[model samples]
Target: MEQLSNNYGEFAHFPEKVIQFGEGNFMRGFVDWQLQQMNKQGLFNGSAVVVQPISQGLGKMLKEQDYLYTVILEGLLDGKTVNTSEIISTVNRVLNPYEEWQEYLALAEDENLEIILSNTTEAGIAYDESDALNDTPPKSFPAKLTALLYKRYQLQKPGFTIIPCELIDRNGEKLLAIIQQYAEHWDLKADFKTWLTKENTFCCSLVDRIVPGYPRDRADELNEKHGYIDNLMVKAEPFMLWVIEGPQKIKEILPLQEAGLNVIVTDDMTPYRERKVHLLNGPHTAMVPLARLAGLETVEEVMLDADFSVFVDDLFARELIPMLDLPEAELAAYAEQIKERFKNPFVRHELSSIALNSVSKFQARLLPILLRFYDTKNSLPLGITAALAALIVSYLQEAGNDDAEVLALFAEAKELPTTEQVAFLLAQTKLWGQDLTEVAPLVDTVNDLVQKIHEVGTRAVIKEIHQQAE
Candidate 1:
């Protein structure tokens, strides 16, 4: 079999217009895949120059394959299973800044470079006070970006449409702030700071896709199937969404929507963020404890069981969706998509993995909806309340994964009376951001649910909730 490379077939070369940080599976499968779609449609006639964000990366392997790889998308689409593969050639080259610092900095001088994309993980966006501007390639992603931005500023080049795909809230804004801090710390001048702020468009983006990179398990079979030894083949889910919180002008620049891609360029991404949190993530967090307690190992396992499936459906239709301010139909459609994603055959999403730090997950994903549902309907959302009860019970049973402090608190709470335990957990303002006990009937409702869960098994309680909803 031929190695997956440009040598095997002719490939089009476009002007380098995007400097992407992080040459990981996610960028290749998600951002670069979308870019390839746009380029094929003549909407975005450019390729990305991938800069390895860290010292150790896939730069050598990517370069070996001529920066070409295949992305296999397997998942349900529109109520039907769709499996597709396409060779992504949107990456022009991969540069390791550690080895080729000068060449990496030279990319900043490219007159055509207009977009900056990154997914350096959530921790990659932090400010490291130790980073110096003079370093060949600064340690942190933000610092490296700051150095590159300073280089571009020196050349008086047009600033980039900086869109960071980090999972943090306000990712672009936070990246910009970190760069500005570096500017202040390094004394890069007020004029440079002005250019950084005014010339550049920092777009906070929300990206969703599951890229289980490098299918090593089936590599030999897939290599023979494709007739190519693809070292960088990435396996991803068919569903993808990129919501860029930016000005409308960015739409004209990228034009991904013209290429029939799932890209949303909005001025505010709060509603979209809320939709994802409430619909997709909230349900995942809420299901983890109950599902794990019921001996379900994976998300698909929970979704496959008839009663648990209906319980999750009602949790969405009756509880989570009503709290959102977006169009009911749009929310409903997204909820259905999430359901399909949960049941993805290719993905084995473990309940215990999702259960990690579930305290914070519950606080962020479900608490707002729980509060809003109560305020709007003037009644407790039984499904969510039950989930909360299950969470506490899981911790009490020593089945939860959380910070040591939180685990210790739950350990101590386990010895208290049922009502007192409920009250004690609810009153931990530091954990919940506010005293949940103040909400009338909340503590009592949760106490009742916890007691009921202890009496009946987790599966029985879920069946009861679904029956009541029906």
Candidate 2:
């Protein structure tokens, strides 16, 4: 018998009521997949209409499949390796506003639309001053949303709730405020603001899922067993979290908590938000650069590297762990879980993707550890600092095969006069948001280590950093 693309027949059908702004991996793997569980469990019956937020992307491809795509969830489930794929029929249509602008706006008048979910990346939620109300799609996500909300207000009162899944702090609330900024700038009517205030609700949400999308290389081998060519196959880490800061009414509307899934509906999801960013995401950013330079291709490889292995564990255990407010045991458990996640082996985390704005990433991830180390220990450890130094040198290099993609992505390296003046680049207030250079020993240490990276190869630097940590 011919194998099916995915196990689609097992899941139940639901009313298409959720308007998702992004037709991407995270939204499909995280939000739509979770809804499948809720729909299957008979708690919530809601499907989604995925909109292509950007002008370019998978909208055309998704439309070819009747908006039906396979989600292949891969990871350890209760100590057993479980990899499953099911065609998610929850998406009714994939609409591209750049082409189908009117139909995209028509969703605003959708009376049954209870949720406006989005994951348009970190920079997606911004103000584009020139974005006109009548543009095909506004310059920014918030502007487009503002226009849509205004359309909804004019149609009648509002019934939709917004749950932003963007990887930013207080995503829903931040996006809502940005929309309000658009409203104020454009001088939208008072009734619209009142409708925004009274009729509509923006619930701040924190979502966690490492969705390694479309195992392109492995799809053929994996398909031999399942018996179908599943091109839209998706993969994710075996964990998920959706923490929404909303009232009891939201609980009633979104019954995801009833499914025994990890859905936390609380008055404040701030702690959980901080917990995810500081613990899970922080390590990925901190490790990616140095690990990539050390000849490790994937996160799993980085975790398993004989030299960098202990260095990473020690870095997190000694430097990063103490910065967190959690108990030592709890922090250790989380760190161990992160290490295990890195060892997933299934997902291929490309170093170049994480290397975008890497200086910013280092500031966000490692700078906190550096500062806390000084405040508590009064001296920064050499190994972690050396990793940061290697990262900076990687970013600085103009010619190299490995870091070529990363270097290309950056807006031409214009700052800093010479390689010897690396510390001056680290001192940039625009990058770190504060003067991190003055934070004693860190500046000189990073500068010195960067010089060493310039002299010795990445492998040697990795060995030295590891030895220093030991």
Candidate that would win on lDDT: 1
Instruction: Show model 1 residue runs off by greater than 4 Å.
Output: 76-81, 98-103, 135-137, 210-218, 285-298, 346-470
- Candidate 1 local lDDT, 245-343, one digit each (tens): 989998898998888888899888998888886788788888988888788987889899987898899999999888889899999998987887988
Q: Which pairs clash in the backbone of model 2? A: none
TM-score of each: 0.76, 0.87
lDDT agreement with native, every candidate: 0.86, 0.73
Worst 10 residues of 2 by lDDT: 402-411
How many clashing residue pairs, candidate 1?
A: 0
Model 2, 1-470: lDDT tens digits are: 33342243444556778988898888888888887888888888889988888788787777665566778777775678877777777887788888888998898777888788898876566667888887878867888888888998888946578888876777787887888888888888987888897888898888887887877668778777556655566777767888998887877787888887888999988767766776777777767767776667777777777766776777777777777777789878877877777788777766655565565556555666677778888888555577677776676664333223234433244354555355665666655658767876777777677667668766677677666656
TM-score winner = 2
